[model samples]
Target: MPYALPLPLAPSWWSRLLARVPVRERRPRLRVVAAPHGGGTAPPTLTELYLARRLDMVRLALFLVDDLPTAEDVVQDAFAAVCRAYGTSLDGLQDPGAYLHTAVVNAARSVLRRRRTARAYVPPHPGAGAPVDEGLLLAEEHRDVLDALAELTRRQREVLVLRYWSELTEEQIARTLGLSRGTVKSTASRALDALERKLAKRTETGR
Candidate 1:
């Protein structure tokens, strides 16, 4: 086996619908074996770690990114990256869980950069059978906020999204983006200020 990235596995009707493109016939170079800290031995390999954490990651990415297809793309990319770095202790990845989490977050930001028209947050779908009020989530006020976020520059939007949505510390965001903590804080505060101004303008206009 060549240790390639795992194929996306979706257990949803939507997934089947979207995945009609046909899975390739190629075999994986990397195969995930069951973890055995006490069950056996050998630290979890890249694939094993990914399989253990895939569902949560997929869910988080979908929520953060709104678009299901894009979420899969982001995760797949991140997984491939993790695999690529598995050589030589994988950047001291002593904590695979943390590494994957960070990778997913960074991937989500990358997706936002590509789909520049997307809002700051994607509202959850009521149709997905998850019990949440989609209408309330997508209310006029919230819509205005997302629209305003979309209007801002990508860097500002990214900093805010990572800080607020991903719940990443300033230091984490800085490391992920290869930026200084001061820069991350400055961008986030500036973004928040701009969003506030826009929201105030919108509220005043409505009144």
Candidate 2:
């Protein structure tokens, strides 16, 4: 059940991202974690956290890294880092979910860094092993958006994904990305504008 996600419950921002397409009541095919209830229950163990959030984190990493296999690797490395540092019980961590989120983000950055430094990286050609991941059962419209997203700068994509997909607040995104609140705000603003322009151009060009 490693590929299992709860259901399609997209946030409002996701709809906005697909506004260019005809509104069909479609939701983003990603797992959105519910807010934690207020109580004194013990924090989730590392295994519990992985079982609950692995697919969701994979989707997040997909947005950052732009492919399924690499995204899965990013998530695996993130969890491995968490286990190495905190062990299975996650005893000393107050918010394991947030820590995991930050780990995934950081791991994705490392992947992008390595990709940039590599001398002979070949971009994935169209129609070659792109539509194969069952865990990433994204629609054609969603793929269009992803194509446009790939045009954005890595920082812009990071800010937009964390802000819209992860539903993180400005302060949380700033802390996760190690930028100021002001920087996060400006980055998200610019990212959204840029995404809209890219999507719009896609619509106009009909490509």
Candidate 3:
């Protein structure tokens, strides 16, 4: 009679372990165990991770990119990149959540870069018509704020958006943008001042 090896733990066991841990402690760290009958060990897949964090990722991307469809595309591309780079198993990734966040941010940046390039290549005609942005859907009160937001430089805008919209701490923003905490603080301060000045100017002009 042939002896059979013990089957590996089910994915639910890993999910339970994850649920018990605090959010900050929930890093990817599953071991691969060889199956009894098969080629090799199958590590945990990204499916659970996707299901758990997809909505939050989409929101984050939306804040960065400012369009729902573009945000969705950015998130989908981020997940696809992660899968391609790490495989469906997400093996060897220490923090897949962080990886996804960074990927989405980078993708959003790329979209902005392309927009800037396209704008430079195509000069606007006098009173040229343009497509309405979805930002118009925001309340009238918010339009002023968004207009002021658009006046800020890209780096300033990113710092403000990540700080306020995403509510990430200075340290978190520093790590995400690969900048020093001091830089993040200074940039945020300057961005806020710039926004206040823009809003003030807008109010004065309206009166």
Candidate 4:
């Protein structure tokens, strides 16, 4: 019953993974206000921000958590947290966009943490297979890359996704993940090497 932002259509494999999220009516727009800076462009109202960045945040969450419904929940929780902390107008927050990005990352981590704890007490159940569409095509290479990413440790996946997919700088990734810049750089390097190994092995096995 929660609001589900429709994932945008794209040829990327992640888009395939996200294609079935149900759409919901958007909440009414909040009043927009001038940004703190004089003569600067106004910061987006919470609704505007949701419209513009929801797809990207969902992509980030999908990569982190690897499930469409859970990813949607993570993003919704992120926006709710922002609204709770800064209100709908988002007044007084110097960098609301960055804050929202961090919120998504943190929310995804919380989901993973809670999932881990739940698994200790609950029996694992097979997930319902998402219905596949013949019309929604994904490249084989894209599928391979996603499979490779899944083999990565959570920190490695976070570093690589933030670095390459999100196009965040090392410092930005460090800030979002609460790691030192050096640690981010090293993790990215090691993650890339491990990913390459996995992809290469897959290729050889397929041959």
Candidate 5:
């Protein structure tokens, strides 16, 4: 067995507990390496599957996070998790793509949550004047999109990313986020409506 050696023991409470305990997934390599897809004697393996889908994870992640670098990091992390979960048999997993998609979405959500927690409110002392913006702001549509995205609530952001970037239907988005289909639809509608307003303002002000 891939787990511990099958010890000959009579059926009992202790044995049942040991059997039910899950196997801990090993930490993936720092850099991912997929198994060989085509070889003389060997067959298609999980490693090859991993490499094939790595690019897809990156693309799917970008629409959710809206930052290419961050998205790549997220994909890499997700891949690590997937590889860690890889079993020698690859049984019971009817759809690896579904598994990867769910993992990436969860990882992205975790990243966003950590960012928010890191931003816990800190009051400024009397002498600490508001920090000055050293003129890094650029005038562009991408910037406008960034601003609009930042303004959205977290759920709105996720819904928009799934609907537009991932091209998922409301039912799919809802299933991914663990929300109702109606909620997903409502969130996307609100997010898009707000983004349109922001774009309109930018157009009128020439900013």
Candidate 6:
């Protein structure tokens, strides 16, 4: 059986966790092997998929986890798992893109699970700076937005980012997130309303 990559939250709440965090220095790019999409006869190879989709997948994972290294790790692990499960020939799979999308989402959930577990047991040391320091790295406006974003439920965050930033249609998002179209639509509506309220509150308080 294919490993089920269930979302940590319900489909209606497939949100992300954004924190005020420092951006890491850019890492060297992954070397991509060029391969043409197999014509009517064959499916595109995994190498082709990686070369084409790695950046986009990384961005998706980054949006979810809010950390570049963790996002990259999530993508790397997803690819490695697929390679292990299917070898180089992905021809038989119905939708490799969807499979990879599920993999990245599952991997990101695993990272967050571990992070939450670690935080439960480990207390911060005295005099330690915030795990994420926004003031030094982000402008006031950016910080306010992110701070407001952080207040949202994980599923709400996910819905908004996928809807707006990723520019996925409701049906596409439903498919990617294993949600019903109705659920996606309602969640996005509520999330938008909530985000607007949060931003407005912040603005009013700042003034």
Choose the strongest candidate by TM-score.
Answer: 2
Candidate 2 lDDT over 1-207, as tens digits, reads 121112254433366454533332222232334335853445667888888788778878988887888899999999999999999877677777778889999999999888777735766545455546533345455666888778899888888888766668788888888899999989878987888887777778996
Candidate number achieving the greatest lDDT relative to the actual structure: 2
Worst 10 residues of 4 by lDDT: 131-140
lDDT of 6 by residue, 54-150 (tens): 8777767866776666778999999987788777777565666778877887788899889889889999555442235323433343545556666
TM-score, one value per model: 0.52, 0.77, 0.65, 0.75, 0.61, 0.68
With a 3 Å backbone cut-off (N, CA, C), the pairs that clash in candidate 3 are none
Tell me how far candidate 2 lies from the true structure as C-alpha RMSD in angstroms.
7.0
Off by over 4 Å in 1: 1-66, 87-92, 105-141, 205-207
Better structure of 1 and 6 per TM-score: 6
Off by over 4 Å in 3: 1-45, 124-141, 204-207
Poorest lDDT segment (10 consecutive residues) of candidate 6: 10-19
Clashing pairs in 4: none
TM-score of 6: 0.68
Cα lDDT of model 3 by residue, 36-122, tens digit: 689466545688668766766765675566566777788888889889899887877766666777787888889888878888999
Q: After superposition, how far is residue 120 of candidate 6 from its true place, in Å?
A: 1.2
lDDT of 5 by residue, 1-207 (tens): 223322253223223323443332332322323445742233224676566666656656754665656677898887777667766334444556556677888888888777667667644334342123211121232455555666778788777655654456677777778999988877777777787787678768986
Candidate 4 — what's its lDDT?
Answer: 0.73
| Model 5 worst lDDT run, 10 consecutive residues | 130-139
Displacement of the residue 23 alpha carbon in candidate 6, Å = 18
Better of 1 and 6 by lDDT: 6
Q: Provide the RMSD of all predictions against the true structure, rounded to 1 decimal.
A: 13.7, 7.0, 13.7, 7.6, 18.7, 9.3
Q: Which of candidates 1 and 2 is the stronger one according to lDDT?
A: 2
Candidate 2 overall Cα lDDT vs. reference? 0.75
Clashes of each: 5, 0, 0, 0, 3, 7
